[model samples]
Every structure is written in C-alpha cells, then in structure tokens.
Target: MSFDHEQRRPADYAAYGSDIDAGLQAHMRRVYNTMCIGLGITGLTAYVVASVPALASVILTPPLFYVVAFAPLAFLWFGFSPQRIQRMSAGEATRMFAIFSGIMGLSMATLFLVFTHESIARVFFITAGTFAATSLYGYTTKRDLTKMGSFLFMGFMGIFFASLINMFFHSAAVHFAVSVIGVVVFTGLAAWDTQYIKESYRYNAMDDSANARLAITGALRMYLNFINLFQSLLSLLGDRR
Candidate 1:
C-alpha cells in the first residue's frame, strides 16, 4: 500500500505492468475528460453572462468585478487548497470544481466586452492546439519531466506576483513580457503535469480512495494550465473590440 519510492518497483513498474499501464491510460483519459467538461461549463457560462447586457453590466462593474476577479483565488485557498482537495471525496471535488469554474467564467466575462469575438476565438483555438500537443509530448515522451517541475513552479509564482505589481504600473511592455512568459510557463507545466500524473499511478490495492483523488488532482492541474495559457495568449494576441 506504500507509494514510497524505495518500496515501489522503480524499474519493474509493478508486477502487472500491462494491466497497470492500461489502467493508467484509462485514468488519464478520465482526468482529461473531466477537465474538458469543466472548461465547457466555464466557457458557456461566460458567453451567456457576457451576452446579456444586464448581467454583464452588473457583474463587470467595479466592486462586483473586484469580487469576481478575486473569487477564484479565494476558491483556490479556501475551497481547493492542495491539502484539502487531495483528501476530498469524489462528490466534494466535483462540486468544488464546478463552483471554481463558474466563478472564473464570471470573472472572465469582461473579455467579451474588451476583445473582438474573432480574436478571442482565434486565441482559444491556438491555446487548445498548443496544450494538446505539449500534453501529448509529456504523456508519450521517454524523458522524465520531474527535473523541470521546480523551475516551472518558480516561473509560475513569478508570473503571479508580477501580475499584482503590474496592476498599478500598467506598463504595456511589462505586461507583454509577462504575457509571453505566462504562456511558456503554463505550456511547460501542462506537459510536466501530464507526465507526473501518468507516472504516479498506484496499485488498486494501495488506497483506492487516494487513487481516485489523484484523477481529480490531475484534472485540476491540467485545467489550471489550460486556463492560464488561454488567458495569457488572449491578453497578448486578442484584438480589442
């Protein structure tokens, strides 16, 4: 039942390698499917809210926009904290994920008013193509991605903190630089996360509860990467309406 590195067969990949491999593939598929469904909900919600002048006007205004802008971060801390979410039951995870995406959709609804629909669509497809290809590389490649994990985590934090500062500075060049870095970091993260998730699969005998939670964790990680990638590309490349 131990996932300890010393205990698990690092070389053998467990005795039932084929069965475990097949199970891992299925697990990864479920992770991806869950992430995509969450994204669909976010996108649909954003479009619906944005299309309605009343809703958009109410939500996109100052105090309300601030709440929307901050809601996802709050969700990350209060609801989806790493320690908390890793132990969450399937139903709890699903509900929390749905709520997080809903809040994000509300926050992002302003994009519809700010950018041309054509540009938003273009950036979305671009982000999707890039994420899919990079994630595939992570899943299929032989090279270990663990080495890149720490570096990418640092880059992610740098982007996040820099964003706070840029809120006031509002320098176009600084914004552009961060946007470019944001895309690169998130893309690399998507690949790394995919590989990590694939390699971290445990035996069914080992705690079924933890194994199930792993899929939810993987979906959340990949979803964050996709959302960040889309937002960064949209900021840099999307045309204003």
Candidate 2:
C-alpha cells in the first residue's frame, strides 16, 4: 500500500510541474506578443510619418519637433508611475503602449533623414538578431541576473546624463563614447530585464492583476531597451544619407 501511494505521488507531482511550466510559458508568450505588437506599431508609424511630406513637415517644424522629440520621456514618466495612477486598467495600459510607440516613431523619423535606407535596414536586422539571442540566453540560462541589475541601472543613468551633456557641448568624442557605452548598457539591460520579467511571472502567477501589470511593464521595458540599443548601434555603424 505504501509503495503504491509513493509511485502515484511522484506521477502527480510530475503532472503538476508540467502544468506550471506550460502556464509560465504561455504567460511569457503574452508578454513577448505585446512587445512585438508595440514594436510593429512603432515601425509602421515611423515609416508613415517619415514618408508623408505633410506629416514630416509638421513634425520637423521647430516647436513640433521639440515636442515630438521629448514625448517619449513624458510617456516613460507616466508609465513608470503606476502608484500615482492606480485607476489605470489593462486596456488603458495597452492604449498607453500604443501612444508611446507612436511618439517614439515620430521621434525616430529623423533616422530616415539621417541614414541611408540600406544601412538603416542592415542595422535594424543586426539589432533584432542581437536582442533575440540575448533574450533567449537570459530566459534559458540558470545563472541569476538579479545582482547585475543595479550595476547596469547605474551605468545606464550615467550614460544618459553624459549623453544629455554632450548635446549641449556638441563633442564628437563624447558622442562616440556615449554610443559605445550606450550599446553596452542597453545590451546588459536587455538580458537583465528578460530575466526579471521571467522571474516576475513566476512570483506573481496566481495574481491576475499583478500579472497584467507585469506584462505591460515588461513589454515597455524591453521595447525601450531594444529601441535604445538599435539607435546606439545605428549611430556606431550606419552610413549617413
């Protein structure tokens, strides 16, 4: 009787474990899907805005240009402040993601004017490949990336400040250095954020509200990382138009 119960217990545990794994994978898929959709929206909007003469003219106007350029920062601030906007729903989150993507697309339209089409395409593919590989490694690796997150965060902030200062100084050397460091910082962030998102799913699996928030937040983080990395890499490698 005892032996029979023991054998059944193992089988039951195995089945339970399998179910949990499947659920976790499905949740992660949702997160990635949201991120992909956001990226698609951003890309389409960018192309349309850049190619339309009237739209480009409006966006490139001095005042409108500053607004479009700074729009991403505003969206990011709002997105990060969930506590201040507790009434926000998942649908609202999705809408925010769309709006943010559109803003980013408008900002990125400058790339169309600055870089050769072929070079931009090449650099985009490179960024996609690198992001995929890094994210996959983060998801599958057994090593914990949590410890590296703080260090990477500090590095990102430092680089961000330097980049801002360089805009005023207009230093070519500073720009080159920022691009190189920006690539490294964002690359690290991509992996760390992937791991953080995966672990967050495991931690909040039973809470639907938390899970929804995590999905949107994770998507936003990954999307930003991808855009920043792509821009940095493009600056380093792309041929100017």
Candidate 3:
C-alpha cells in the first residue's frame, strides 16, 4: 500500500527516453509473468488436491477445513502487510507469493468439487480475455483512473461486507446481486490497478530493490482481480457438478 514515490532523474530520462520505455515494458511483463506463475501454482495445487479423495477428505472436511479456508487471510495480516512487504527482499517476497498461492488453491478446491471442469475452464478463459482488454485500455488510454480506482475500492469493500453477511443469511437473491456486482467491480479494478502499477513504475525505475518489490505487489493486485472476476463469472455461468 505504501509505495516509495522517488522520482526518476530528469537528466536520465532526457538522455535515455527509449531505454526508460523499454524498462517500463520489461517491468510490466515481469508483473504479468509473476502473476501467471502464481496462478499456475494455484491451479496445479487445486487440481491435485481435488483429485485425491483422501487428501480432500482430510483437508476439505469440517473443523480443520476452516483453518485452510482462512490461512491466506492470516498470512496477509501477519506476513504480507505493507510494513512487512517494504522490508522483504526479492527472494522473500517470491517465496511468500508462492506459499500464498498454494494456500489459495486449498481454499478454492471446493470449486472443482462443485462445478464441472469444462465450465471452470470456460469461465477462466473468459476472465482472462476480459482482463487483457481492460488492462490494455488502462495502459494506453489518456484518461486518469485514480478517482475511478478510489470509487471501485469503496464498492469492493461494500461487496466484501455483503458477502460476509450473506454467508450467515444464505440468501439466494443477495448472492446473485453480490456475484453480479463482484464481476463489475473486479473488471473495473483490473484496469485501475493496471494503470496504477504502470504509473508507479515511472517513479521507482532507478532502484532495483524498489522495482523488485513493486513488481511483486503489482502482480498480487492483478492476480486478485483475475481470481475474483473468474469466481464471479463461474458463479453466474459455470455448470454445477
């Protein structure tokens, strides 16, 4: 959440504008590549756990399952806080991301149990396409998305609270509304976050350590958007097993 906005040297930019642009492109690719790797980890872990009956029974069953379900939240609170992230080395951040992705897979294994694999795959591709287009717009468009990001973040919090309430109420109508709003909110967030990350790179371009940490955080933001969008779309479109 806390990014160092150390401005790049004006002389350096004037002298090597092309080089700076190339660095920005490479930085964005690094962000996307890390996100894809995290997704791969999550997908593989989810499939392996879901395919094993014994493993599923032990981890996805009852009282112990809550531990798995909430472990990512605990990790975010204690390990991946802004303060902790600021202090982490590149290697440490990478390990944290891998561990978080695996935990997320365990939490989401129920998706495989509830929905047909074909529909899950279909929804994932749809989410990916939408993410790509929105992110491209964010990167290329002249319009500033900072204010939109703030508004969408508020909507995101409202959706979060509504989801928590619906978990207790178990209302079909609320769930439906939340799913629709979640899809919209996450879609917009994908663009906002992409623009935010792109802009941040301009400021932190000179520092390797800052850039390394920024890439991880940027990837984390985009990865969350993709996951939430995919889940929302799956809730609306996936065929139940």
Candidate 4:
C-alpha cells in the first residue's frame, strides 16, 4: 500500500506539471499572436500612408512634420498609462492598441521616404532575426532579468534625452551616437520585457478579466519594444535613398 501511494504521487505531480506547462504555452502564444497582429496593422498602415503622394506631401510640411514625428511618443504615453488604462475595458484597450499602431505607422511612414527600399528590407530582416533570438532567450531561460530591466530603462532614458537635445543641435555625430545607444537600450528592453511579461502571466493567471487586460498590456509592451528596436537598427544600418 505504501509503495502504491508513492508511485501514484509521482504520477499526479507529473500530470500537474504537464498541465501547467501547457497553460503557460497557450498564454505565451496569445501574447505573441496579439503582438504579431499589431505589427501587421502598423506595417500595413505605414505602407499605405507612405504610398499616398498627397498625404506624404502634406506630412512633409514643417508644422505637420513635427506633429507626425512626435505623434508616436504621444500615443505611447497615453497607451501605457496604467491609471488611464485601468478604467478601460478589454475592447477599449484593444481599440487603443489599433489606434496607437496607426499613429505610429503614420509617423514611421517617413522612413519609406528617407531610406532606399533595399536597405530598409535588409535592416528589417536583421532586426527581426535579432529580436526573435533575444526574445526566445528571455522566454526560455531561467535566469532572473529583473536586474537588467532597471539598467536598460536608464539607458533608454539617456538615449531619449540625448536624442531630444540632438534635435536642436543637428549634429551628425550625436545622431550616430543616439542610434547606437538606442539599438542597445531597446535590445536589452526586448529581452527584459519579454521575461517580465511571462512572469506577469504566472502572477495573474487566475483572474480571467485580469488575464485579458494583462495579455493586451503585454502585447502592447512587446510590440513597442520590437518596433523601436527595428527603427533604431534601421537608422544605424539603412542607406538613405
């Protein structure tokens, strides 16, 4: 009887472990799916907007150029505001994601005008490969990335401030420095954010509504990280048209 009980306990534990693994995988899949859809929307919107001669012309006007350039930052600030988003429904959050994607696409459409098509495509694939590898490491590794998060956040802020100052200075050196730092900062953020998102699921898996909110939020975070990384890498590596 004692031997039988011990054997049954191991079987029970194994089954429980398998179930947990399956659930975690499904959760990760949902997060990635949501992010991929957002990226698709953003890319399509950018392409469409860039291809419209009249709209592109309008956006290139000085006053409108500034607005188009800064719109992504504004949307990001609004979308990631926890206090503001807390009151929002899941549908509302999803809508916000779509709106934010469109705004970002509008801003990034200028990239099509600035860089050669071949260079843009080349940089995009490079960015995609790097992002995939880093994110995979973050998701699969057992190491704690919590410490890396703070360092990366600081680096991002530094890059942000430098980029802002360089806007007025118009220094090519400054631009090059900012691009390099931006790529590094965002690459670290991609890994750290991926791990953080996964851990968040472990913490909030029990509440269905909370899980839905978290899924959307996680998607938003990862999407932004991926987009920013790609843009920064492109700035560094892409040839101008």
Winning model by TM-score:
3
lDDT of 1 by residue, 132-226 (tens): 99999999999988989999999999999999899889989988989999999999999999988887774442556776788888888999999
Off by over 4 Å in 3: 1-14
Which candidate achieves the best lDDT against the true structure? 3
lDDT of 3 at 159: 90
Return the lDDT, model 1, position 38. 86
Error of 3 at 196 (Å): 0.6
Q: Whole-model Cα lDDT per candidate?
A: 0.87, 0.85, 0.90, 0.83
| lDDT digits (tens) for residues 21-140 of candidate 3 | 899999999999999999999999999999999999999997888898888778888988646777999889989998999998998998999999999999999999999999999899
Rank by lDDT (best first): 3, 1, 2, 4
Candidate 2 total steric clashes: 0
Where model 1 places Cα greater than 4 Å from the true spot, the runs are 1-15, 202-206
**Candidate 1 collision pairs:** none
Task: Assess every candidate by TM-score.
Answer: 0.91, 0.91, 0.93, 0.90
How many clashes (backbone N, Cα, C below 3 Å) per candidate?
Answer: 0, 0, 0, 0
TM-score of 2: 0.91
| Candidate 4 deviation (Cα RMSD) | 3.2
Q: List the residue pairs that clash in candidate 2.
A: none
| Candidate 2 local lDDT, residue 14 | 88
Error of 3 at 187 (Å): 0.6
